[model samples]
Target: MEVRSAPSLLPILRSRQQGEVLTYLMCDPDRETSMSELAHRVGVPLSSVHREVERAEAAGIITSRRSGNTRFVRADTDSPYYDSLSDLLVKAFGPPHVLAEALEGVEGIEAAYVYGSWAARLHGVAGRRPVNDIDVLVLGEPDRAELYEALGGVEGRLGRPVNVVIRDAGWLRDGSGSFHATVTERPVVAIEIKKQLGRDPVPQSS
Candidate 1:
């Protein structure tokens, strides 16, 4: 499963300060959810949760209806965009990238960015189909692409396919990036600190 693109998740991410709230609601397992339960689960103030819910409803990511005093939220998975994004997620989390990073034994890889589906889950939006393969952006080096290729080979020896995205420290310094804006958002995972450490609590070292 290879994902070139997903539903314009860009819209969902940029939908305001409540991006995490709406994302959690859509990814919740319940077909229809209640306002109070949602607020409680997200651990935000009731008022702030309500504000986000309203914004999400307007964006059409969720469907809400009143039954007596409760409002239910069901994800619009039927939306034309849902399938595309879901498929991308299936392909994205295929294998853990920590396997590669730990084996490489090369320091200065700097920041390892786990973008895409796994990041969405970290923010509390778990897709039905999650692959868990680490999708990373390696922010380091003077030459971006060439450096990525070199690191990719190092991981290749470790048996994990590493898609290392090298970012030129100088270019990053200059702020000329109009291309990588899509992946710059926060990572989608539950244990975010594991991302920085470059190792899982339980190593899958079969």
Candidate 2:
């Protein structure tokens, strides 16, 4: 089930703006957001966001309400496709979404990060080459088999092999080590798993 790269969500979605809009709203279903907020987060014009919101509402994908001068919108959890769409969005953008979902409920994952070439591009690595595999640096003592089983879904979604390197607090503490030095020196995409707060968060190096 290994893949070479992440799959594009554009084909299934109406446009890039639509995908962004879905990712934002779907990621935080409980939170209600305003048109301006959605526009800002999606990096699209207010008009475009408004149109997309309207379309989504008509399709019963989103629900809207008015609070005086501002209108608030939230995903319709009751929608028939709610779970399905949520899964699709997560798999479509595996870095955080899929990775986060996979790591959920796993035993001992402290903090996880996406490193190497894929992370480099996300960190705006200039002239970065395409990534054929995803390099994940996991911290803590989670079972290796369990971790791989979790990431198996992500491998299919991203169309790339997920090469995971497990490390405990001891390895993370050794700043002198080559692996630690390289990850600390480069861009790393943190996987924010709320339950596994094993230690203080490691700030990504700028």
Q: Where does candidate 2 clash, by residue pair?
A: 3-159, 3-160, 4-159
> At residue 204, what lDDT does model 1 achieve?
15
Candidate 2, residue 68: Cα displacement in angstroms equals 7.7
Q: What TM-score fits each model?
A: 0.36, 0.62
Instruction: Give the poorly placed runs of model 1, Cα more than 4 Å off.
Output: 1-12, 15-17, 28-30, 85-206
Worst 10 residues of 1 by lDDT: 197-206
Give the Å error, residue 120, model 1. 14
Q: List, residue by residue over 1-206, the lDDT tens digit for candidate 2.
A: 11123223324565556766776687657868999988885567888889889998999989999999999999899999787786666444446656877888788887888887766654445443456788888888898888889888668766688889988755656546777778877878777676876653555643
Q: CA lDDT, every prediction?
A: 0.47, 0.72
Kindly list the per-residue Cα lDDT of model 1 for residues 1-206, writing each as its tens digit. 11222223333343322544554544332546677776765455677777777865676656778999887776677566555543332233322333333424444554444556555654445477743344565554425554455556534332344554556433223434554545543443222223355422211110
The candidate scoring highest on TM-score is: 2
Off by over 4 Å in 2: 1-22, 26-93
Error of 1 at 75 (Å): 0.8
Maximum-lDDT candidate:
2
